[model samples]
Every structure is written in C-alpha cells, then in structure tokens.
Target: MTTMTTRTVEYPADGLTMVGHLAIPAGVGRRPAVLLGPEGPGLNDVQRRRADALAELGYVALAFDINGGRWFSDPEEMMAYIMPLLDDTERMRGIGYAALDVLRAEPRTDPDRIAAIGYGTGGAIALELGRDGVDLRAIGTINAVTTGRPGEAANIRCPVWAGVGSEDPIMPPAQREAFAAEMQAAGVDWRLVVYGGAEHAFHHPNVDHAVRPGVSHHPLHAERAWRDVVGLLAECLPVTE
Candidate 1:
C-alpha cells in the first residue's frame, strides 16, 4: 500500500470562497487525476475519505466544495442554494471549471489525463463540465441523471456513466430516458445503471443532515456503484505503475 498526503485548498468560485480537499499519492511522477464533487449538502468527511481512497489507488484526487466550506443540514436550506445554481448552467460550469483548474495546478497531476465524478448536485456539475466540452477522460455521476440545453451534449468528448436508483422520485424513469436521449442525440458514449429497489442518494449512507424524503442509503448498491465508477476510471484513465 502507498502512503498518501492530504491537504485543504482554498479557491474562489461562484462569488464564494471554495475550500477543497486534495489528496496525492506518495510516489513521484505525474499521475492521472480525478475531480470529486459532493452531494448537495456540501463537501463532507465522506467525500474527503473518498479522495484519500483515490490517492491510495495512486491517483491524485480533489474533493471540491460547493458552499464555501459550509454544510447544509436542512433540506430546505440546501435546496434554496442548490436549485438556483442548478438553473444557472453557466454558474455550475464555473464551479466545475474552478475545481478542475485547482486539480490541474497540482504538480503531481497529469492534467491531460483526468476524470470527474460526482454525486447528486455534484453529479450535475460534472455533467455540466462535460457539456461545456472540457477534455476529460471519463465522467461518472451517481443519482444525477440530468439533461442539458439542446445540442450542448455534443460538446462532451468522453464517455459518461451514470447510476441511479429505481425508486428515485427525483430522477424517475422519464428523466433517465431523457438523459439517454440527449447523449444518444449528441453521439456521445454514455451508459446508465439503475440500482434496483434503491432510492435517491442510494450510494450515500445516512448523513447527519436531513435529506429529501426519497433519499436513502443502500449499502449493497452503494458498494456496487463505487466499483462501477472505479471500473470506468480504470478503463478510461489507467494509472501507469
């Protein structure tokens, strides 16, 4: 096993101070990197741990912030902030790009080989980055099957993978189909995995904050989704040991 180094980084985005967690592998030389986005609540310990895990796998990882280091414990408060941001495509893209720039600035990262993975609101940002035509090796989202403006998906130059829960009211069947349609229409390589009997935010365990009604954790499916995302990364951005 390789030792990993972690640190707190601060950057400006969306008119707020963004605090991100960066994890780097111990070995020398540039390595493929990943930009990690957290759920709507904000960047939490769970996401920081995920970044560390990615570093353990020999990839530089950065878990970017959404609320300037603040975590929203109230559902209504979270939505109050997230809903408007979601509606603003350019704002979301700005946040994602800011985080991407931070990751690329790390000396250990191979900027040319990078990927973006996010959950929920974070996932939407990741997709927006793809739609913005950022050069990414792969894009993976869990419980954030969203559609972008007409004809924008054509900008996505890499494969996209999305995971959703069958019982997720927030992202019901219709929404999934629409997302698939957009990807197909754009001729982009994309795939969607529906976790049977799961609900919104299925990959996230019970959080200290109050989540929406349909949001619940499915440990089994969560692990499976993690594996799927890892597989996507390994296939698209393999680490050269």
Candidate 2:
C-alpha cells in the first residue's frame, strides 16, 4: 500500500483552503518531492491518482488545488471559473510558487531536488514558474495551452518537457511550432512531443467534453505521455540511490 496523507493548506490571497494529497514512499528519508499543479479549474481525482502513483515510485508528491474548492460538473462552468484565473498572469505564477514553497516546507521532501508537473492550465502555470527562475530541478506539462504573452519563454531556466496532442485545436500545430521556436531562441532546454490523433485533456480520462473543434481523447497517447513525463522526471531529477 502507498503511504500518503491528505490535508488542506490555506492560501491567504484567496482565503481559500486548498486540498492537497501528500504521498511519500514508505521507508524513504528526505526524498525528492513534486508539486503537481492541477488542470485549469482545480484539483480532481485524476491529479490525486497521479500524485499517489508518484509516491509509489518513491517520491513525495503534493497535488494542490487552485479553484477555490468548487468542482464544476459542467464544462462551461469549468471554463467560466478557469478563464478568469488564466487571465491573471501574476496570480497564476504566485499559485505555482506558493505550492512549491509548501512542498519544500515538508520535512520529508528534499527542497533542492524539487520539481513540478502541471496539466492543462496548470501546465501554463508550471511554465510561468520556470520563466520566473523558480530554481526547479525540472518541469513537465501535458496539453498546456500556451496563451500567455509573447517572449515569456525567455524566463525559463530549468529544462522543460511539453506533451501535446497532434490534433489539439486549442494548441494547433502552428502555435506549437512557434512556442518551440521561442524556447529554442531563449536557449532553454526543452522538448516537445506531439502524439498523433490525440486531443486536449488527454490525460484526464474523466473529461468528456470536446472543448476544441474535432478533438477527443486517445488512451494510448495519454499513457505514452504519462510515461514520457515520468521519464523526464527521472532524467532531470533522479532520486539518490
């Protein structure tokens, strides 16, 4: 069985208590930790499952919430709540940094070996954190919408691995290419993997809506992206033997 603890941490800015699941490997001492930023709206069971899986792999994982404790069963409602937060770039960056700090404060987590993994809106936040020079060991994103302002990629210091669906209309091929170019120009170590025929929100099997035109999930691609993320984490922030 995985050794994990669930708790709520208060974020003073919004006066909202964020739910988090901290999973630590059994018998491991001061292991590396991952601050997992959830998809745009909030922390869901999917993110929690990922955190649990990460903990089973011998790392302390903290899956945090940003959406003020509201779970939108309707896609429209989820977008309504998420869009506003995405528009506030500074707040998004703060959210990522705050979560990172929380993970670092944990006694079982190795502060120096900390990293981040974000999905969807959380992915953009992860990129923002890297751009702000967050001293992260590495960063990974899954189906992130790179809607932030131009030249923002120049701020990233840590290596980034971004996974996207080839058929994701929200982040089309042209946009992905431009984003990759910007990262290259910034001299940031980055890799972009496009899974053919997949769509946005591929990581979340529970997401049933087609937010983008002609886009849907691909289980095989999603699984591959998950493995790619795990491999990137291992390569960039290997656990000490």
Candidate 3:
C-alpha cells in the first residue's frame, strides 16, 4: 500500500471557522488534486475516508466542511440551515471558494489541475463553483443536481457527470430534467446517469442516518460510480508519477 499523510486544517468562511480534512499521497512531487464536498448533514468519516481513497490513487484530496465541521443526525435540523443558504448564492459561493483556496494553497496540489466531487449539499456547492466560472477539470456529483441561477451555467468550463437514483425523491425526474436542460442550454459537456432500482444516496454505505428511507446503499452502483469518476479524473486530471 502507498503511504499517505492526513491532517485537519481550519480556515475561515461563511462567517465560521471552517475545518477541512486534507490527504496527500506519499510522493514528494505535486499532483492533480480533487475537492470533496460532503452531504447536507455535514462532513463525516465517510467524506474524510474518500479523501484518503483519492490519496491512494495519487491525487491530493481535501474534504471541506460546510457547517463549521458539524455533523447532524437530525434531518429537520439539517434542512433548517441548508434551505436558507440555498436562497443565498453568494454565501454558497463564498464557502466553496474558501475551501478551493485552501486546496490550491496546499504544496502538494497542482493548482491548475483540479477536480470537484460532491455528495448532497456538497454536490450543489461543486456545481456552484462550476457555475461561478472556476476552471475545474471535471465535476462529479450525486443526489445534488440542483440547478443554479439562470444564465450562470454557461460559465462552467469542465465536463460534468452527475448520477442519481431513479427513485430519489429529493432529486426527482423533474429536477433531473431541469438539470439536464440547464447543462444543455449552457453548452456544457455533461452526462447524467440514472441508476435503476436505487434510491437517493445509493452510493453511500450502510450507515445510520436520520433520513434513510429515500436513501440506500447499492454496492453494485457504488462501485460502478467510483470507477466512472476515476476514469473521469484519469482523462481530465491525470496524475503522472
């Protein structure tokens, strides 16, 4: 197994001292990096472990916090905080940019070659960064295909790949259609994968969550999605040894 280094760092954003988990591969040379956004309830071990997995693949990865490093077990409480931010695009942008800055500032990160992958609310933030005109190499999202302000989609320069469960209530057929329309209208190189018989958060493993009904763990699709995202990074942000 390749050696890896992991650490926790704090940076200010959204009027809070946001904490983020950073993972870097053992090689001394700088590498292509990826920013990971956690689900709405907030950052957790799952997201941090994802950073480690990326590190194993020779990519610098940072899983940034959205709620000041707080993880919520209550669905209602999570929405109470997230719904208002949804209305304030600028605030969301501020949060995303702050974390991006941290990732770029890392010595091991190849600032110019970076990608963003997010789940749930984190996915929305990644999309927002794309919409805000960040030069991302690739964008991967799941269960968070929320569209942004009209006309802003044109700013996205990277190829976007989004996946969602067919029966996801949060990201229903209408929402997916709208997201597709926005990507098409913006002339983005985008693709949406609808996993059959899977519900929201299907890529997530079997863990305790407040809202589990609409979400599930589909091992087959989970592995498939991981491979697709890996292929994306290889194509867009190859890490040369």
lDDT by residue (112-197, candidate 2, tens digit) is 89888999888888888887778888889888847456766677778989999887877898889877887888888989998887
In terms of TM-score, how similar is model 2 to the real structure? 0.91
Q: Which pairs of residues collide in model 2? A: 131-155
The whole-model lDDT of each prediction reads 0.94, 0.79, 0.91
Per-residue lDDT tens digits of candidate 3, residues 1-241?
4599999989999999998999999889999999999888888898899899999999999999999978887778988999888778898889999999999999999999999999988899999999999999999998888999999999999999999989888899999999999999999999999988778888878642356667778889988888888888898888897
TM-score, one value per model: 0.97, 0.91, 0.96
Question: Which candidate, 1 or 2, has the higher TM-score?
Answer: 1
Query: Candidate 2: where is the Cα deviation over 4 Å?
Result: 1-10, 13-15, 145-152, 209-215
Q: Which ranges of candidate 3 are over 4 A from the true structure?
A: 207-212
Q: Which of the two candidates, 1 or 3, achieves a greater lDDT against the reference?
A: 1
Best by TM-score: 1
- List, residue by residue over 94-162, the lDDT tens digit for candidate 1: 999999999999999999999999999999999999999899999999989999999999999999999
Highest lDDT model number: 1
In candidate 3, how many Å is residue 98 off?
A: 0.5
